[model samples]
Target: MGIKVNLDEMLHQRRMTLTELSGRVGISLTNLSILKNGRSKGIRFSTLSSICSELDCEPGDILARDHSSLEGED
Candidate 1:
């Protein structure tokens, strides 16, 4: 995928556990794991907002684009 989820790194910087984030964000661990592992096809804005609020970060902090992969795209 061209978009990478930097959840693990953000969590590490915040010293937060997935379980704790799940509770704070009112999301399930399974769903959070899918996101953390980069297995998610997409994410809801509300969900992203909640995560950002709890983690004290922006969407850029959690997600990044692989410019190299887009180099050949029109």
Candidate 2:
């Protein structure tokens, strides 16, 4: 399974820019960009909470699990 971040989609849906979200979420643009691009390995709970608060979205809306795995069945 893999975890996916749909930050870009959410940002578009909310009509907000990455720079604006970075400022509002108290996170650096580079770090936010990394997270947005799915290059981030992990995110802190506090940071996630701040992002959710600013975007008015839940964790489920921002993240999803993909069950397609190569190690499972043949």
Candidate 3:
């Protein structure tokens, strides 16, 4: 299953930047970059909750199922 991180879209919609979010979430910019770039293997619930709270969204708004990856399954 492909888990897609839509941070860019959410940030755009929220009129926010990574650096701004990092401060508001109390997370480092580098670590946020890792998650924003989809390079992180996983994220803790507490972290996720913090992000969602700051973004004013639900977890589903950040992470989504990349159904495109399952297109060729038989």
Candidate 4:
């Protein structure tokens, strides 16, 4: 299975910049960049909560699961 963060798309859709989101969410720009670039291995609940609150979006809006490849791994 794999997880995908659609943050870039959402950011585009909302016409918001990374710097703006970082300030609004109170997360460091580097960390936010990592998340946006899908380089983050995990995310803290508090961070996720902050992002959701700031973006006014659900977790689903930012995250997605893909099980198709995993299904063939066995």
lDDT of 4 at 3: 79
lDDT string for model 3 (15-69, tens) is 9999999999999999999999988889999999999999999999999987777
Report the C-alpha lDDT of model 1 over 1-74, residue by residue, as the tens digit.
28889999999999999999999999999999999998898999999999999999999999998665665543
- All candidates' lDDT scores? 0.93, 0.88, 0.93, 0.86
Instruction: State residue 34's C-alpha deviation in candidate 1, in Å.
Output: 0.2
Number of the predicted model whose TM-score against the real structure is largest? 3
* TM-score versus the correct structure, for each prediction: 0.88, 0.88, 0.89, 0.85
Candidate 4 minimal-lDDT segment of 10 residues: 65-74
Residue 10 CA displacement from its true place in model 3, Å: 0.6
What tens-digit string does per-residue lDDT give for candidate 4 at 1-74?
A: 67779898888888889899999988899999999887898999889888888778899999998665465442
Taking every candidate in turn, the Cα RMSD to the unseen true structure, in Å, is 2.7, 3.0, 3.0, 2.6
RMSD of 1: 2.7
